[model samples]
Target: MINAFGALRPDQPIHVFTKASRWLLDRTITVPVTIVEQAVDSGAIQRDSLQLDVPATLASAAQFEAGADEAAVALAREFRARHVQVAVCDAPPMPCTAAHLAGVPAVVLANFTWDWIFEDFIAEHPAFAELPARLGVRYARADAAWRLPMHGGFGTVRTVLDFPWIARRSRRGRAELRRLIGAGDARPLVLISFGGYGVANMALAHHAGAPYRLVLSGGAEHSPTDAPPDALHLDRERLDALGLRYEDLVAAVDVVASKPGYGIVSECVANGAALLYTDRGRFREYPVMVDEMPQVLPCRHIANASLASDRWDEEVAGLLAQPRPEIRPLVNGADVAAGMISAML
Candidate 1:
């Protein structure tokens, strides 16, 4: 949403509705919603949190549904008060409900909607049987659903656009960031990131026996002795201090070790960084993203169990020995989506 709106013309005014979920904060490693709220508060964007209690986990569907309704009513009132005509969101159904209630056009921008994710659980747990249908009905109200690459295409919405990948461009040069991270010009830098929920045991990366510096994303607080003398934790604060964006770190690195997430995968592929990833348990997008590896860029699969063990050392060494090729996947997605939304106004 930040990137898209940044691409908008100067005349366009955009109001973003941010919300935080305590349920999500407890589960995620980074609590991204809080970061979004922080960004808004810091004047990075024109936005505010709805102050609603949104449930992030599927097990909390009952609470989520009730919360969504309350949030929808509050959000609709805000949209009307602001004279907003269009809305866009990635997951959860409340914003769609708000846009519909406020009689505004909504564009659902995501690799897969929440309903698509709920459908995967329905077969195993019957409690989610009605959820797919109910959520689908809410998402169907969108004017358009633009699906990003490496997505598990949605069954709920018929008009899904095969949207190009969206990634942040690198601001600082490679040498400068490497120097900031305290990595030597010769040694390779490997970044281990698993989104907001971090990997518990990264000490195993030390066993690779390669002369590489391992950088952990999200800053879980590590001792200098955690890995080798060279391993470091590159938290958001560290990146900010170096004037580097998250994507800048990803772009500057030799390899990115991450789970199969649309944002990370798309960024790695588009920016020409080697992707070494592991399975994300029960995530619907994992299968499609993993299957897309060989087709897009050089990638390797790291087992979940091996993440805590020293068994992945050989694979890590092999991946590090390979060359890094930059893959550019139409970086104009934000501009395109922004233009589409602008036309609606």
Candidate 2:
């Protein structure tokens, strides 16, 4: 999983880039990590076979150029000097450089939950188009590029790997919530956030008679300040791939109304829930950027708010009225990923 929100600085609170990257790393096999984020250098950490985070002893902080090629090269050299094998890297700051310089292949991919139902969106994105030369420098797998036409430009397909499917961990904090409206009767529950923009969506939730849960993830720059009902509190936990936050909720919620950011949508699709979006546009936090964005969600691409759009609300209501669908294990992007990584190694 490669995170970019720390670089793009989106308006919402969620860190899509880091979330996606960690999710992939979680489902896959053991791979040492040296995270190079803009303005910070998180020391190296060892991973487990199941990709779970065990206690990691940190080294002295090293200098890394923010989003610079030199930083990547420096890290690679450090790895070589220490005789350490660098398995994977997140976007920018040298995963590509490490692959190019070290002769290891880089599998560039967006996290699974983010890209699920949006019309093979990888082809519509910019990173896929821009990273090829860097990729071709040695061996590389543009993870979802071939499947998602939006991620690439006109080019021949190379390796195909599935990035990990990261479900949300919203349910963990559910018990902590106090109570906003003391049971406003019965209404649909919607989770809303413009991804670290700090937009307070309680009004929308209130209007729709739905309770919304806001997730403040990662070490974001500006945390969400506005408050919703105490019943709806903050969930500030780091959820790796094994977490069942999304799996549990998707099995329970009416509709997953969110901005068409990749991870959330992918989770909705895998969970078998209908999706509704307030609108559509560019999200710097989005790991994969696509031009023909509408095609991203083959299931539902909503322009107006679910509360505002009659057809969308009708659709949502229809979904809620039916018996809840059983949530099942979704696509194993990491296994596809493991195959790609193994081929490269």
Candidate 3:
């Protein structure tokens, strides 16, 4: 969403609505944002109190639905007062319903919708059975939906438009960032990205003698107590101090070792970096990305067992050995989406 915001016309007015607890909002976004109280919180994978329990979230569905109802009323009131012409969101159900309630046209931007994701969990936990259909009904209210690359099926949306990758480009050069991280040596720099909700019990220390130098974000809970000399754990403060953003480090690296998520995949494609991915649980979006991402960039999958055991040398070599795609997909979906939104206005 930030990428699309940056791509919009300088004179265009925009407002962002997100959850209050979203960590990325603080780290990446600069625009004034409105916190939506009833917003569905992201699931965390760490072994901490903050970890999002799927069963718990499903059990509280009624509470979330009631919150969404209140949020829609408030948002609709605000939209009418402001005379807002169009509403844009990243596949949130409340925003779509709110826009509909305000009699405003809504444009949904996403690779996958919450409805599709929730359906995957219904078999394991029956509490999620109704969520998919309910969310789908709301999502279908959108004026249009922009489907990005490595996308999943959007069965509920009425009008779906395909778009290229929307990604953040690296402002700093590779050599400059490598120097900043003290990775001057010829060894490959592998960025371990598991998103803000980090993985627990990751054996990062076991890769001490690997051919690559590992770089982990400080936000990740997967860091071992006894880290190797080759590993570099950088927090947001360190990144800011070194005059770099997370995307800059991603662009600088030879390969990003991660579970296939939209953010990391798009960034890798935009910056011409290889991907060494692993399974990210039962989320339906994982298979879609793993299958489709390789056609755009060099991508190789490592098993979850291999990742946990730090047996990544083979996968890393395979990913590096693969040649990049000759005809790369355009990374200008943000610009294209901005134009589409402008046209609506």
Candidate 4:
């Protein structure tokens, strides 16, 4: 969403409201962001820990609901003080409700809503039965929604407008990124990314004799304690010193091996890199992304067991061998969304 925000009219004043997390603060977003501590938690599923912690998720939801009124009051105060005309959110229920409460026109940009996502968890914990409906009410308060592709059914939001993929493209060239990462053109470079919270017990030494060079970002926190010779762990500081962004590494890679998430999938598409994906548990968005990704780029699926056991060479080979799609989707959704937001202003 920050990438789309960057594309908005240069003269338009935009303020981003988000939780203060290392994952968000580390990125270079050219916009004024207002960090609202403890506004909400989406209870994101950890790829390494596939087991859904129903109790924890439910508790997080309750906490979010408990602070909604207070958060809304603060947001309303800010909106009035700034003379904000329109509020934009990447499909957060609280922001929509808060914007409505503040009497600010809210535009939601997302492929799926939390109401649709939480619906998948009701069977695991019956307490989650009411969450979907409750969140649906908040989502309906939004003035409009800009739905992206590869999305679930958003039954709550009243006014919906379909939009293209809003993905960040690489700013640097492939050769430059490879040189920065110390990866030569002789071997294939594969990026191992599992989002902000990386997988648990990831043994990078398992890829000791692998055919490709492995790269990991955000330091040794995610790297194997005994990493193999071929593995290159790029810390945040190293990346910053080299002037390379995450998207640049994605563009330089031959393939991305991980669970299929919207951010990674869109980046791979924009950079022309193949994807070797594994199952991301039972999240509703997983199936939709897995189904839709193959149409735009070369993609292959590997079981979680195969991924964990270091048996990913076959899938990686398949992904690399697969030809690129003759017709690719437009990678300029951020600009398109910016144009719409400009008109709205």
Candidate 5:
């Protein structure tokens, strides 16, 4: 979205506001601010820490909603102060509400929204029962919403082009990347990534019994200490220093093993790599992503419990045996979004 906007209007200012506060909700969300910080440091986008306000993790649903509402106020204050004309948001309704409060156009672009995610947990966690409705009210404030394929079915926004894939499209050939990563050519190298925060209770050593080389990205925080010595660990800092984004590594590898998040799934398919994914508990987007991604890529799923056991051996073998499917990349949604934002501007 940022790149597309820049392409359309190079002189326009683009500032990314990401939530930052200590939060213990999901380890998966724990490092989002850090990731954004890195992106800002990389000079990809300008950042204003003042607009980023979120509660600490472990806040109850009521507390979460209240915090988001409070954050919206701060976001509005920042927008007014900065004279922001349009708010292009990927997060929930907080940013959108801020845009509304500032009487500016709120353009939401994403595959999933917060209401759909909260819906799944509402039944079990009563604190979240009222959250869906609250989020719905705030989401309705967006002036425009541009959606992507295999979404959570929450937002009724017009479907835009396919979400842009940010990975480096061209990568070192398999043989070269394999040699650089110290993996033998006989076995395929699988890049394992579960976003920034690693999945809990997963043992990469389980794949040690398989014929492939397992490269775990950002897994040191959650991986068991007994993880296999042969398993490779690549933190984000090292990835940045090498001038390699995760998708570049993904493109070089034979298979990408990850959770069914939109960013990773879209990048894997766009890069023409096969997918070996697992569940992210009851995350609302997973079911849709799992159903849709297999249409374009050779996709296989492994059970959460089986992740710590030898069950991945058969699945990996089967995925490797399948022919690599041809990937026809879709038109990027960023351009469509940029066009829309341009009209509003």
Candidate 6:
């Protein structure tokens, strides 16, 4: 447990993470996080590079795309025996519950949907109180010295955008984006995407028949092979670069249809893209993660999925016509995390 600890985000902005994790690594822990398609290995914890995932993540990605399955008692039993340890993992309702049942020493869940659903369960049980819409890493010493409700450590970083990357905008993304969005095919452009691939799929499906043309940003982890004929898929290979020089594809589009990851929100705000969000269950900070005042202006989320509704279109159009606000990105999450770490050490 001396090297470092990691409960990495499986479906998140890779560039943002590489940068954020480095801040701590350069100043504190030396070991780095190892992430593959869905599997992630944190710095040495219990064993060399101990994996912090709950039982479900090891079961293969297909069976539990939305969340982990609880029905399989055998799988759960085996996963718990191997994975049981002080760790942090974004366990939605079912899998997290399974991990708790299986007897993990400490669990830190990153996202929210299952957090809310299982809040009572975690809090009431005395084993899972650490997860309460809280971010950063959550854990206790082998003897339970640190407890739940801890916000962060080291340096506090609120908006993930502060960590720049070398990602570039694709040539296609550079084109003036125009899409039909509204009651008629003559409407303007409206794009939708979450920082991750799964959220992008939700946006495309939500506005399948809308008059607007949508552009979806895809990363190496995700692509446009199966995308609708009308949707434009853009490459994000440039994100791995060091300078963080990136294109403003969302800015050219009329309205953005996507989940607002903390970094994505700032990037969209930086680009001046009109945002129309579909809130994923637990990642509420996506919309509010920014400290910049203007970031709030262009961003918005629908209460439900209903593109055809006249009111929905009106709301979108109204925001599009309004003047945009200007604001700088916020930074605090990593600082808070660093401080927490100091206390823990």
List the candidate numbers ranked by TM-score, top first: 4, 3, 1, 5, 2, 6
| Model 4 root-mean-square deviation | 2.3
Cα-based lDDT at residue 344, candidate 6: 41
What local distance difference test score does each model get? 0.65, 0.38, 0.76, 0.76, 0.62, 0.38
Q: TM-score of every model?
A: 0.82, 0.50, 0.89, 0.91, 0.78, 0.42
What lDDT does model 5 reach?
0.62
TM-score-wise, the better of 2 and 6 is 2
| lDDT assessment of candidate 2 | 0.38
RMSD, one per candidate, in order: 6.9, 12.4, 2.9, 2.3, 7.3, 12.8
Query: For model 5, how does the per-residue alpha-carbon lDDT over 1-345 read when each residue is reduced to its tens digit?
Result: 565667678777666565342232222221222122211000111111101111211134456566777777877888898788998767557777888899998866777777776676666667556767887777787876676767664454433344543322435565565555556557777787765445445444444556777776664575454556677676666665665556667777778877776777777776767788766654566677777776777889876556566546677778877876566657466566777788887
Best by TM-score: 4
Clashes of each: 4, 38, 0, 0, 2, 39
Per-residue lDDT tens digits for candidate 6, residues 40-112, read 2221111111112332222222233223334324434744555433333332223333444555532332322
Q: What lDDT is reached at residue 167 by model 4?
A: 82
Candidate 1 has an lDDT of 0.65
Q: Which ten residues in a row have the lowest lDDT in candidate 6?
A: 43-52
**Sequence-dependent TM-score of model 2:** 0.50
Off by over 4 Å in 4: 1-8, 32-38, 45-52
Q: Please, what are the lDDT tens digits per residue for candidate 1 over residues 1-345?
A: 444554455565656555554443333222122122311111111111101122234556644664666767777888798788787776556677788899998778877777776677677777657766877777877767887777764666657788777665666777777787777657677787665445543455343445666776665543222555556667767766876667777877878877767777777776667888876566566788877766676789877567656545566577866755455467667777878877777
Residue 218 lDDT (model 3): 65
Tens-place lDDT per residue, model 2, 1-345, is 222321232321221123335544443322334433332234323231112121221111112322435656765565466443323433332344554566544444443211122123236543333333432432233322323222332132255543445333333332222122122334555444344333433223333222333333323333333433433323334323334343445434446655555556655655455565554433323334333332333233444444332334555555455554344444444345434443443
**What tens-digit string does per-residue lDDT give for candidate 4 at 14-119?**
6656665746565757565554454444655342534455567676886676677677777778877877778777767887777888888887787888888888
Shift in Å, residue 240, candidate 1:
2.2
